[model samples]
Target chain A: MSSSSPEQLLAEIRHHCTQSWTLMEVCGGQTHALLRHGIDQLLPAEIHLIHGPGCPVCVTASERIDQALELAARPEVILCSFGDMLRVPGRQGRNLLAVRAEGGDVRVVYSPLDVLAVAQQHPDRLVVFLAVGFETTAPATALLARRALLAGVPNLTLLVCHVRVPPVLHAMLNAPQCQVQGLLAAGNVCAVMGQAEYNALAAEHRRPIVVTGFSAMELLQGILQAVDQLERGAHRVENGYRRAAAEQGNHAAQALIQQVFHPIDCQWRGLGWIPGGGLALREPFASLAVERRVAPPVSAPASPEQAQGCISGLVLQGLARPSACPHFRRPCTPEQPLGAPMVSSEGACAAYYRYQR
Target chain B: MCLAVPGELVSINEHHDPLWRTGDVSFGGVLRQVSLACVPEAQLGDQLLVHVGMALAVLEP
Candidate 1:
């Protein structure tokens, strides 16, 4: 806890709550933490918490999943990725796990570096690590890229689907369906990308953007800060998680990101394409990209379709809650996820299905 | 997902090239090897923001 404890922060939030305000927490980790600790229930009814598209797994474009499924199906290639991404269905109800069931060499690893060992052991096979995350995890992937390059690990390649926060936030604010008045930005993203990018967005949108951590007390403190700004009619970027994040974030990390990757137009599953929304390998490392090395036999990319009656797109845009989805609890439990939101551990629907409901 | 937590830097493995250094970070009792490439100034006993096995920033108490 900082100077103020969780109880004090909650009390201050209650005292400052004079009117109804809709605030969105942009990180799924924070969303789950809030629900887990019953912090949302502790807040005054005047404050509404809207979930944002901060879960990387939930926002991963369906086409990329199709591509991953194709790559994983290759007999000479060993596909590795985070655990949460394995079960998400892509097109025609096929996921990486399904490919694994068919004898595809799919392995779950905690970190990207773990893929290096697999590459070293199986020198004859191509080891492809699926890099999917925001700025918080980009540095790690960037480091891996550099390491693989330095080691001249010809057998190792990366399938990068790294997304940035600013452009996506810009998209949501410009969206007509979005009703968010204030935002609690993901602290770890700020810990890497810095608070400078958020300053302009907060100023343009006239909304308080507070960089927040993923804990009940830290989240409550962040919400309180957002509410205070809303009541005072202030639009500024604030740092509630000052312990780790700074105005000018880790510059070394930024430099590493600059050296390793470049931005490109990226398609989000529900939100569609955002200019400069995704990161691609730089010139020197382009040769180490899985997409560059592997050419699928298919003539065209698979056009994935969203399952009918799944309101995951609406839920991601904050237009509807998880419970509002017809199949949220019925046909779309964690055991059998109908959409990415239900499958991702940090997903809003999964959080609601597990904690809120 | 931009989920990261604070962990204590238990030890630093210095490479001939400083930027390639790494550290063993302990979150509660669980330990993981994290790249110190981002936070080159990070020292032993410093709290770091570990996400996806990379040290993003140093946490000052």
Candidate 2:
């Protein structure tokens, strides 16, 4: 509902940003949109925009990717995943693409539900969908689980790696090295999960949380709102993307998620394990979990970053820029990535390489 | 990845079970069948924010 133009919003941000304030945007899509539009360069020098660990592809544990690779390697298992996840390397630089090159059945799916069709077509094979995303994407997987269960599809299973935003936000703010003063919550996530958790986060951390959209104008408006709050010494949750996100969000989607999944301690690749940061299928839908059918190869104790000379941990924590990494462009190009950030399109490293570089 | 596109609902395929309802949404010139189970009240010509073949929210004008 922001009527202000991008120019007006930028001007307002400039007027209010009297002191240096570091703000982290907790969504990879938002990070890509900001860099794509050059919003970071357009902002005042005092307003530093740092990226958070929002890229689901970037945050997915390497062990999980290894498990996916293992599953895909099986002749009877058809592994399906989002396109961005295919290139992310697990331990020893192994990935799904490499498995596919070795004659493994790895398929890139546009939606999780697409696997149901694959399962239906090949009843002899096990169709496993590697579900990796935040709240915005979890609901779709939830719906898929519900439909598959209702239809009694026996061959379809899910490798659920869905993560939550609020817990990660709490983890980031609680870190000793955390420099983020305010946050621009992903609007798409807010559109589904609502603002209640963000409101609590703002109050607990004494920082403003502005639910922001993906457009350049919406990002600017969110920055202005955050700056306005910071300058006034007030901290609260503000909905800058009111057009799509409501205070309560889509009730039906939330209900579906609640019915199908629950939160549990899950590992983020670079950020380490955050309590209640990941989702797993609830008891009713427990039979749909891939792990229940086939045991995942027990991975070595997961290191923060799989590749040496990759500072993705710092990059994910908003402590270091992607370009600051020693192997950023030289050895870590997208074609030959050293970390998940470089592999994922929504990753900060990818955004920097695509835009700033 | 939380990227979602606002598409216009071109048509809805009603089913006996509301969860089975689907819609054809137009994203610019591209038309794709999207699940309308999330936004059951979505009508024709309504703008919807879709992600992963599912309509997540109805956009307000």
Candidate 3:
């Protein structure tokens, strides 16, 4: 299979390209891979790749960041989260790193369970872990919650913000402005939640959803499959990342997530509340939830003027590209990010800045 | 962060505490320690899709 190189795959894709096809890769990782390898440049002009709202950091609600910032300010609390999330600007331009600069005890953790060790060591203090991301990350946080329950760690609390892919895809497809003709599904997410959930969505929307991995060859192959499907007028769920993804996905991970988390209507930053879009701790693990312990200061929602010409909302919706934003390279570079898309490595703006721009 | 890379499990250490069971995962040539707490069923030489120092799923291939 390695002998049939990306060049060979590109030939196949070029042969199948007979019309204009606007496809959205649902994961930011794929977006980066495509740009890094120049796969997008190799594709036929008709095959337009639209970046989707797959970056967890880009889609995470600002209110949740405000809550994290509030928790980090407490003298008895130790806030832990992934590295990129620290720089994502919340409401009023404040972030966890900014709070840490002001003596807030916010630390970067490699894993959610690392906070469990922190909680064990500092029994007197509260260890609040920011649980974020899609299905790929949900299992890890859920496992941490179950372990916390089993270990009986009373000091650990989770600020949950897990999301699902299928629901958001459904919302995007149903939206009147959506121009996406096909999709490259997030492989890691499908590895946990399985591909069955996408079947109905594919049939209903009449758009092929191909589950793909991060490698350039995998993505090119996925795009090839999607384009072929579009050409044939066949809309179904295809597994291009068969080596890691399966039809049913990881059942053990799914079971663990189900035990620890329940679906809730959660708000996405650029996109508003999506029904059953996010996850919160289930009743059994409610005590470990951070929202119950700390009351976040509710600031007024961000105004259009406050967004400061950052069209991340349009970018996330695939209506506009990152470079299309007026402030994209001018004031919204990764070093001085005006939005989460610039701060997070997986964000579309960051990917475009590093590669295309 | 939803970004995860596929790594090959080199070995599994059963001597340590079971809850903290760990294995050495090699992504291409880079090696790192990953927790097997979530995937207790993971065996030696398994390809795991690792995220944030934890093996979230085992690749069938």
What ranges in model 3 sit over 4 Å off? A1-3, A301-306, B15-21, B27-31
User: Poorest 10 consecutive residues of model 1 chain A by lDDT?
Assistant: A299-308
- Listed per model in order, the count of residue pairs whose N, CA or C atoms clash below 3 Å is 1, 0, 0
> Candidate 2 — which residues are off by over 4 angstroms?
A1-4, A301-307
Candidate models: Cα lDDT each: 0.87, 0.90, 0.87
| Residue pairs clashing, model 3 | none
- Each model's TM-score for chain A is 0.96, 0.97, 0.97
Candidate 1, residue A62: Cα displacement in angstroms equals: 0.7
Report model 3's chain A TM-score: 0.97
Cα-based TM-score, every candidate: 0.96, 0.98, 0.95
Candidate 2 on B1-61: residue-level lDDT in tens?
A: 7889999999889998878899999999799999998898899999999999999999998
> Each model's interface RMSD (Å)?
1.1, 0.7, 1.7
Best of the candidates, TM-score: 2
DockQ of each: 0.81, 0.89, 0.64
lDDT of 3 by residue, A1-357 (tens): 232789899888888889999999999988888999998888989999999999999898888888888889989999999999998888777788889999999989888878889999999999999888899888888878888998999989999988987888899999999999999999999988888889999999999999988898899889989999999999999999888887898887888789888888888888777988998888789889887777767674773315587888888988988998889888778887888888888999999999955
Candidate 2 per-residue lDDT, tens place, A82-158, comes to 99999998877878999999999999999887888999999999999999999999999999999999999999999
Which ranking of candidates, highest DockQ first?
A: 2, 1, 3
lDDT of 2 at A272: 88
> Judged by lDDT against the true structure, how good is candidate 3?
0.87
What candidate 1 gets wrong by more than 4 Å, as runs, is: A1-3, A297-305
